[model samples]
Target: MSDASVFIAGPASWNQIVLLDRLPDPVPHMQFAEESWETLGGTSAGKALSLRGLGRTLLLYAAAGDDDAGRQVRAALETADVPVHWARSAETERHLNLMTRRGARVSLYLSSPAAQSDRDDAALQAAMKASEVIVLDLAAEPQRLLPLATATGRSIWVDVHDYDGTAEFHRPFLAAADVVFCNADRLDDPLAFLHGCIAAGASLAVCTLGAEGAVAVDAHGVEHRVAAVPVEVVDANGAGDAFFAGVLDARLAGHPVPESLAAGAWAASAVLRSRHLHPLLDPHLG
Candidate 1:
């Protein structure tokens, strides 16, 4: 914990990934999966893996069930040498992700982790206090600890994956964040929203566009853009998280916004070529 550069509070789940030709329509029907497998999946887990890949020290705090699925997630992170503090949950989070070759995904939550107690809250708080950056991903635990995170006055980074800009739940996170990242999938106007985030007090705001690239706005009201590093897409499950990790890592190293965005694009490309969250996890996967 003493060497940890960042503290992350969010989910770490075991996911059954099913590669499909296209996302299924709303009608009730069955379709064959092009391929299927289980692996570690969750936004926080992805960030942890990528951060570790970049040689950044981080401590991840997440809830896990007292079950086999939970153990699988825990073991994978341990093997990756990502230090974690696990809270007991009634059930470990699990997702059935239906993805396509073109990068479309529809995730079905099979199980969601529900923390059984607050026994580890104090420890998480101490870790937050010690770390230079605190990343509060969109999850129940992070939401619960938002006030504490604010009190620490550490730079708080939040990723609101596909925030539509009007979801009540995402508002608090948007407001509390010093740095905010989101995808353009649900945003009607990503650049406008990025500027909005800047206007609302975020030091930096980023919006990722799948193939077109990403756009960002810094506190000085300066807009920056970076094209995606073209790559043969393998799996897009963790690309955004990887980008977030990259940008944060580069910024921590005192790089400016444009350079940091390029760093993020490169990191995302690395994940885009891997089947798992990051290439570092390839050897660890059974």
Candidate 2:
């Protein structure tokens, strides 16, 4: 295997959440308590940070509004040492995100028409051409990125966080992916979905089963199952991103499939034991 440098393109957003021991029957409103907010907690930045900690070079490409959220996101990525190679800064597009706690998520996506019009396709293609792998989150327009995938011939990876039940919207990108990652619960039968993705030309398919474990189907159609490392649970928000980062890193380092799965599981376990997805506490990154 060759060392892989990834370019991630998608929305960068802030995540704010409030934790509760149990869901209120009437959805009680609290004046204030302990709340946590991440300046940059979207999938793209999270994956980039996880990969960076594993010593992989990353080139982040995305559009951000020239506002506070964008500034804060850029500062956070800079602190995490992720390279920003093809970012388009615009006064129009605001950062978008979802807030979640204990498996319940609510999205606050920006659907401004001007945002779509501001995308710089040429710059995105330039960055894709320079990368060994390109990973995109479903938050962006898949149609806009598909041509780049075809033009570069670089490995493409897509993380499906939202499913609309329409095959047309997803099939094109799925067919372009070298690897496709999705939460197990997102599919009715993960094994079946893996098969479909494989038939669509995905070289690798991963379905994360939360605390249970994760399954991966490789290029040759071999299925591998790896259990999550046992750990005291804390937060689950970034577990999937960490696992994906691990798989990408291990593969880039030329590790075998079994070892790669183990590393991915270990990375997720580290996230499970932490309050946040920040990699400073993860021993696996070293």
Candidate 3:
């Protein structure tokens, strides 16, 4: 395994920020002035920033349209020093994400057939074969990549964001992954869900409770808990991803479970203190 090689596959988007006095009771529909647009946000950008700060070689596999947004996305990655093996398709469409000051967020996604299409298995296999670890979004086209990861004998890590009560649909992919990280709000009982994930095949499971802390379970059924670092949180957007990157970095460095969790906790806290999701500015991050 190469010490600096990691693969991340996900959707990238251009974010437009709009500040309001308060989120309207039922959401507003007025066309705002041009000043409402603040900054652009991309999930892949955040992930790449976090991983790159750890001195890891990032390989992002995703689709972006043949538009200005796509050009910006590519340019942003290059600026961040993340290498891209992008699979560009003419049918890709740009995604729009809206961020509000009251901690409410919504996304207007323009879906394209090419963007939703599965990645090439052969290319992914080649990358996985040479990578130290593979980080993926469980919400992505798992059917295409999960099996390939399992077949390649690579350590697979998945980020679980949205769960719609259908465990059956997600079980196969979860079982195939080596590590699973999820936000606490996504589950009813985190410990029970960890056990279920272990039963499904995950060797390690971590549940990140936003402000409270995080809990991690190893393959031997041992549980380790890490308390959240004390900080004034400006935004809670990329804390989980920072935590995931920290954990992976520690594990790749051969740290034990407890130490790994500590590193992750520190990274999460650092991200919480930032106004944005850029992980490179985190003081606690290595």
lDDT of 1 by residue, 166-223 (tens): 9999999998999999999898899899999999999999999988889999999999
Q: What digit string (tens of lDDT, one per residue) describes model 2 on residues 1-286?
A: 1223788876555554444454344566753324454435667767887888788888776556667767766766677777774344453233333333444444454432122543566666776777778887764444567776678988888887544335566766776788888876556788888877888788888888876788888888899999888877666667788898899889888998789989998877776666555555243222
Residues 19-113 of candidate 3: C-alpha lDDT, one tens digit per residue: 44444456657754222442334455566677787776878776666777677666666666777667675644444444444234555666532
Tell me each candidate's RMSD, in Å, in order. 1.2, 4.4, 4.3
Best by lDDT: 1
The number of the candidate with the highest TM-score is 1
lDDT of 1 at 132: 89
Clashing pairs in model 1, backbone N/Cα/C closer than 3 A: none
TM-score of each: 0.97, 0.82, 0.82
**Sorted on lDDT, highest at the top, how do the candidates line up?**
1, 2, 3
Choose 1 or 2, whichever is better by lDDT: 1
Angstrom error of the Cα, residue 64, model 3: value is 1.1
**Clash totals for all models, in order?**
0, 0, 0
* CA-lDDT, candidates in order: 0.91, 0.68, 0.67
TM-score of 2: 0.82
lDDT accuracy of residue 227 in candidate 2: 89
Task: Say what the RMSD of model 2 is.
Answer: 4.4
